[model samples]
Target: MKTKAVRLYGKSDLRLEEFELPEITDDEMLAKVVSDSLCMSSYKAALQGGDHKRVPDNVAENPVIIGHEFCGEVVKAGKNVAHLAKPGDKFTVQPAMFYKGSLEAPGYSYPFYGGDATYIIIPSEAFETDCFLKYDGEAFYHGSLAEPMSCIAGGAHVNYHTKFGSYVHEMGIKEGGKMALLAGVGPMGLGTIDYALHASRKPALLVVTDIDPVRLARAEALFTIEEAKKQGVELHYVNTAEKDEAYVMELSGGTGYDDVYVMAPVKPVVEMGDNILGMDGCLNFFAGPTNTEFKAEFNFYDVHYAATHVCSNSGGNTQDMREVLKMMGEGRLEPSVMITHVGGLNCVPEVTLKLHDIPGGKKLIYTQIDMPLTAIDDFAELGKTDAMFAELAKIVERSNGLWSAEAERYLLKNAKPIG
Candidate 1:
């Protein structure tokens, strides 16, 4: 069967092309992709291309599909895994697959099976590795977001405890304790905020710091202090560049944060988060750095005397995706807040190329639809000019500028089919 996909050939080379999909064997499964979210990791992959660790060596001659966070419907399942995932099953798979002790993952390593295509082959390894999750959500986009949301959940799951004269480690943040998200108003940071707010063991005081006052202002608007207070959270948004050290110290009641997350990979931000650690404080290096030799300063005195420690999580596993999915299913967490724009598969190349330059949250690509990428906030303005977009704006506006199941239905109902 022929399918359209965005494939990467090498550095700075991404193409939207049509190719024949190979038949699935008994150990594989075929799925029709619905939604895929563009991620920063994909942006980096595009720049690195063949040099990327997970990119297969033959990518230049045989291009590979390039999206990871996605959800789809099972079209055909091989007999080996048909019992686990059958036809018509709506599902999302954890892209962080380590098959047979290899670092290969979907998007970066697989040739025909990635999120940016209309159909994908789920290798037997995916099923054997326990990366597939059955999704019964209101919208397919939510299933795609479960992957990134799970990454945030993974950070919160990292935990540490010290035994008598020894050390111990655990997953998860300090429950119901003080926490700080530094440089935390960006896309991933926003996801962290959503997860932090609705986490089972919520924080008593959640302080979010950003260098940009504008970004901090936007964060305040999204995660309103009133809402946080109602949820038993004392939330604070601070422009760390402007706010003095004394002010932040005062907010933490003289001690420092119990858990400090450095959302940016910058050196200064990492040091800043380290500096504000309270006794037995845990600093989470949540953001990944692209540079091979990225360095940050830490006070060894505090690490030894005050028991300050550090932890880092690259990505979430299958269990983390399951947790985030359940939270979304229960309505305790809303993953849609991360989505700011939506588009069709054809626009994947453009969107992926200028992803960082774009000033919005998650950009969702609908593989089956041929619509241009439209920002949710722009729908209202577009409604004033274009009738069709205006119709879309109404559904989105009714949901308070947030994408909802009704909005998804409306778009699918009105979208022009791929020709």
Candidate 2:
């Protein structure tokens, strides 16, 4: 059998390549990828290529599958496997897979497995047993968004209650009271918005701040702004880079935000996050700082006196994936509003290299799946335009189609015949 995967040959050297499939042991199951999404961490692994700690140096010789977020359909199961791991069932698999004996892991710990590929060999223990309710990718991406949505869900559950000042039962500190979003734009930021909008009742306002004028324009043009406004909540897009202090003050009515979450990689935003907090505001540093080596200073005087808080989250929890999915199904959230681009698995690596250039709300990497997908046409969106388009010209020039969804389904449906 054959399997095609997106490999990280070297820094900026991610490529979609083909390979032969290994025999599956009786304890293992063979699955074809139905969908996968790009994460910033994907880029990190690619930058270092196979030298990454997750993938062993040996497998690094092969392209380390760059995707950690993905879901797939079981195509084959070993004889020893039970009915529970049967074929045709959908799941958002755990990216890491270890060897039979010693904790000698292969991918991640080595390079035996990773997403951004057409197929994978999954062991029984990598994932939680509760498959049905977990981010039902079928509902969101026709089984496409299993991984991406899961990450959002994962972040939500990563210590959901991180000291939010004081806990008031009714309105104050309530589910839908007041929340702040700093630098809210792009897909990841929008995911945060969607989570805050539908999942958390903490912030009723759901203030989304961004420095990009075009992004702000597109949000309203897209669906979020109007949706947030229609819901009787405030979705304020602020320009922090230019008039940082004034805008923050104006939005809070001089009270400042109650809960602020930063969604971009910018580090200086930390200081601004501290300043924006309303009394006892719980600041969520959602965005990853550019490089771990650098440090940002916080005002000790203000921190102690005001009792402001600052914390962050990594990806999200598996349980949250279920919460996000159920919310989507119940009509409380719509990820379709944020989707702006779609492609097959083959285009993943290339598309990822140039993701910064592609303008618009969200880019959906659709696996060549037979299932239905979600899209928002009339929603204000940033479409991939031709050369004349100024906003996304650079992104257009830089984006690559490494592992495309079409390529994925092709590899899977026509899976390399097992020897």
Q: Estimate each model's TM-score.
A: 0.96, 0.75
Against the hidden true structure, what lDDT does model 1 obtain?
0.87
How close is each model in CA RMSD to the real structure? 1.5, 7.4
TM match of model 2 to true structure: 0.75
The lDDT leader among the candidates is: 1
CA-lDDT, candidates in order:
0.87, 0.56
**Residue 146's lDDT in candidate 1:** 94
Best by TM-score: 1
Give one clash count per candidate, in the order shown: 5, 46
Summarize candidate 2's per-residue lDDT along 378-403 as a digit string, tens digits.
11232343221222223323323122
Error of 1 at 113 (Å): 0.9
- Regions of candidate 2 where Cα sits further than 4 Å from its true position: 50-53, 57-59, 79-81, 94-112, 128-142, 154-176, 224-226, 229-232, 241-243, 367-419
